[model samples]
Target: MIYHGIRLKAKAGVTQEQIEETLESMRNQGRAIPAVKSFVVGRDFGGDFDCGAVFVIEDLDGYGEYLTHPAHAHTDRVGMPLVEKFDSYDITDDDDPQMGAKIADLHRRRYQSDPELAALVSKQP
Candidate 1:
């Protein structure tokens, strides 16, 4: 299984509610897509981006199908207006489901000493 994470910040003046609504819509629409094994979306309280979404797909082909899904296209077209900029990450280790978390924790610990990161987290709303 492959895990994909999308980090995004909402456009100026966009509310958290709208961001969550858009995420909920994606989750609802994913019900029909066979490649989506799991989906999660939310704000990252102490992270770099304002909000993010995660999707668990079986493989590259599955991820490709997800990206091309009509529902996904529609959501990107419509919802992107509310997004400022987004970054993506994909992690896979064949069968280890815990790889994503381990990798994230490794990065977190590595960067924990950066004063700028502390400032960024402290400045969050």
Candidate 2:
């Protein structure tokens, strides 16, 4: 499985309620996307970010589906503006040496296809 994760730090003055809403939105994205095998949305304890989420997908195809899902876009639209810092990474148990490059390519194509997502990410600190 591929575990795609994101870490987020809320902007200054962002209310607790808004943070909760964002967290719930992350959970909603996982729930709405069929390609997601499982997911986690929770606070970060000892890191630069305040919160984080991880979505487990079966393979690259499922990862692509998760990346482009409407619910994922909706979550980004609602959550990104409140994020002060953002970091994303992927961990996979696949043995292929090229797996990392392949995963990066998936994200590159996603950004090329969705300019709005690229723009949203560019705004992060």
Candidate 3:
């Protein structure tokens, strides 16, 4: 399984209501995506970030599906603007040495296909 995790810090002056809305959107994505075997979305305690989320997928194909899901895009569009800082990482049990490169390629292709999404990511501050 691949456990994809994200940590984020909200921008200064971002209201609690807005943060909740984004968190709810993330919760919805976790529930709505078929590729997500399990998920968690909550505040980050011992980290520099303010919040974090993790999604577990069975395989690389499932990870791709989770990333491309409409709900996932919705969360990004609605949540990214409120983000001050963001980081993501993946932990997988797969033994393939190329797995890391393959995952990075998935993100690269995604950004290439959707410039708007890339722009939103670039806007994070």
Candidate 4:
């Protein structure tokens, strides 16, 4: 499995509700794609200066499917116009063991510590 972490920041002056709605719609659209296993969208809760979303995709191939999907193209047409960036990482025991462990620990300390995210992570297969 591969985890594609995407971060998207809406244009200035855009409301959080609008961003959330657009992302929800995008996730729905993503579900129709063949390769996508699951989609999770959430707002950045770290601080006030940041207005962005995080998505955890199950597979890199699915993530590619999403990029080329018509619905995603339509997303570029509608919504607050996001500035998107992504980091792709393969889930492997041998690659950067130390760094991967640190990142996993951080994720646990941050999102997993929260009841909602903890539940979400726990539910993942």
Model 4 misplaced stretches (Cα beyond 4 Å): 47-61, 79-125
CA lDDT, candidate 4, residue 91: 52
Query: Best-fitting candidate, measured by TM-score?
Result: 3
Off by over 4 Å in 2: none
Global lDDT of each candidate: 0.68, 0.92, 0.92, 0.50
- lDDT of each residue in 1-125, candidate 2, tens digit only: 99999999999999999999999989998899999999999998788889999999999999999989989888899899999889999999999999999999988998899998899888787
Residues 1-125 of candidate 4 have per-residue lDDT tens digits of 44444455555577767776777766766566666565565665554323333334444345555555676555444542443332223353335547466545545454444565445334432
Residues 7-122 of candidate 1 have per-residue lDDT tens digits of: 77777899867887777767754675688998887766666578777888886567666765677655555566676776768878676666666556544653374454445434
Error of 4 at 50 (Å): 5.1
Give stretches of model 3 more than 4 Å off.
none
Clashing pairs in 4: none
Candidate 1 Cα misplacement greater than 4 A, ranges:
95-125
Q: Which ten residues in a row have the lowest lDDT in candidate 2?
A: 116-125
State TM-scores per candidate. Answer: 0.66, 0.95, 0.97, 0.49
Residue-level error in angstroms, candidate 3, position 41? 0.7
